[model samples]
Target chain A: MKIFQQSSEFDYSWEEVSTSNWRKYGPWNEKTPHVIAVDTISRTIDPHTGILRTERLITCKQSAPKWVLSILGGQDTSLVYETSYVDPAHKKVTMCAMNITWSDVLSVRETCVYQPSSSAPDAKTNFVQRAEITALCGGWQKIKNSIEQFTVERFQQNAAKGKEGFEMVLEMSRKVFAEQREMLRLQQESKILQEARI
Target chain B: MSASLAPECNQVKEQYDNCFLKWYSEKFLRGTATSDECESLFKQYEQCLSKALKARGIDSMLREAREDNRENDAEHMRPKP
Candidate 1:
């Protein structure tokens, strides 16, 4: 039996995600069914207010066969069936990502962070950035209207689309994190449990 | 493109995604949610998406698609373009 479960607690770790073979799957065909994303060139600086240059692309595929049925049920009763790649139980994957727009200006950096930085991400940092992106997008809907550019609007939109995209990514990466944490937690729990056992 | 999404569709999409993640994260990751909730989410995703599509007026094209499942379910057949 299959059931849907949404995890409220997210484990933020970087190494587990960077290893995914996102390239082999697909590209940002916003027209297709898969959700895809790429980091954009951004710098964090407190430069005097100006248009912040930042852009990111996130795409996804939603396999709602039941919805497809509602589609047929509400309208045409004469229809039959359809085949698709949608597996309701399977978590979606991100296909491709790239970040080529690195800029020297600080205002543009505000897209990814509030502070400024010079170093590109190492493996460890990459994980941190991904977590930052997830946390940012998770709450993006609230701040979207404050901006003027279609770019920011698009950011809000993609944040909406990719929230699950990235969440799924984090969910997969979290399993390993949870297991490791569990091992450590168990050690700690055991010490406490044994005292209780005594 | 002129055929852009309405704010409603956008909101619905977000709700749908959140529901999706929560739905799966529980079952696959935590082993906490029941099978019934998963089925409920599956149906909810369809309605949410359908409403999103209707808000955009793209539901017709998806409805009329000729496919094997639609051949029997009748409801599975999308309307013509």
Candidate 2:
């Protein structure tokens, strides 16, 4: 007598995953302020174009990283692979590694996005449910460099040049990130500069 | 896009592009495949999109982006897993 029964392709497809409302993910307190969330409309990543396109929208300032736009690390997910480390010699310096893995997931797209009532209407949210995932298969050093490059290219001033230049800026950033005390000094200097302008 | 900035530009583009690609690659089918299977998946996607574009004609919308993204995308044709 046969014991195992064959399952159809349809059987393996995602049934559903859902969320209630968009608030600073009630959980992750640290990244919450930097976070924005979509209200939500549960839908599958459309395979119509043979590309996965989910229908979820999140409200946020237009200037946000796509990765940061992602849902938090929960709800049956696979990370693009990353790690954080603290250096020894420069005890305060922290290093982050982001590795890549090609095509390694099938996340079921869940909630879309909605803004609270008090917010402006007609503002477009820029998220879609995450119905897929993959790891960028690079080593920690490789991924760290990617983030360093992204920050400098997009946010900081562009003095970085050849390999040495990138390393310099990355090293500077590491020094600064490890010490929040410098932030107060900068803020005070900024206020003084603003006052001087007046 | 900056000529003087090309070195730095190239640096970030490599990883971001690869990371972005990985998000798509691991989405389905962990099983191994022949080169044909890989090419077919990408080509089939283009074909599928080609079929859908008759209505919205995203093909027309795609020209500029394809041209813009062509070199970037083509650079990764080394059969990365």
Best by TM-score: 1
lDDT of each: 0.30, 0.26
lDDT of 1 at A69: 31
The candidate that wins on lDDT is 1
Clash number for model 1?
Answer: 36
Q: Write the per-residue lDDT of candidate 2 for residues A108-162, one digit (tens) a residue.
A: 1111222212232222212221111222334565553454444334322211111
lDDT of 1 by residue, A108-187 (tens): 11111111111422222221112111112223443332222332343345544444455555455456557967777776
What is candidate 2's CAPRI-style docking category based on DockQ? incorrect
The DockQ of predicted model 1 stands at 0.02
**Least accurate 10 contiguous residues by lDDT in model 2 chain A:** A11-20
What is candidate 1's CA lDDT for residue A108?
A: 15
RMSD of each: 20.7, 23.6
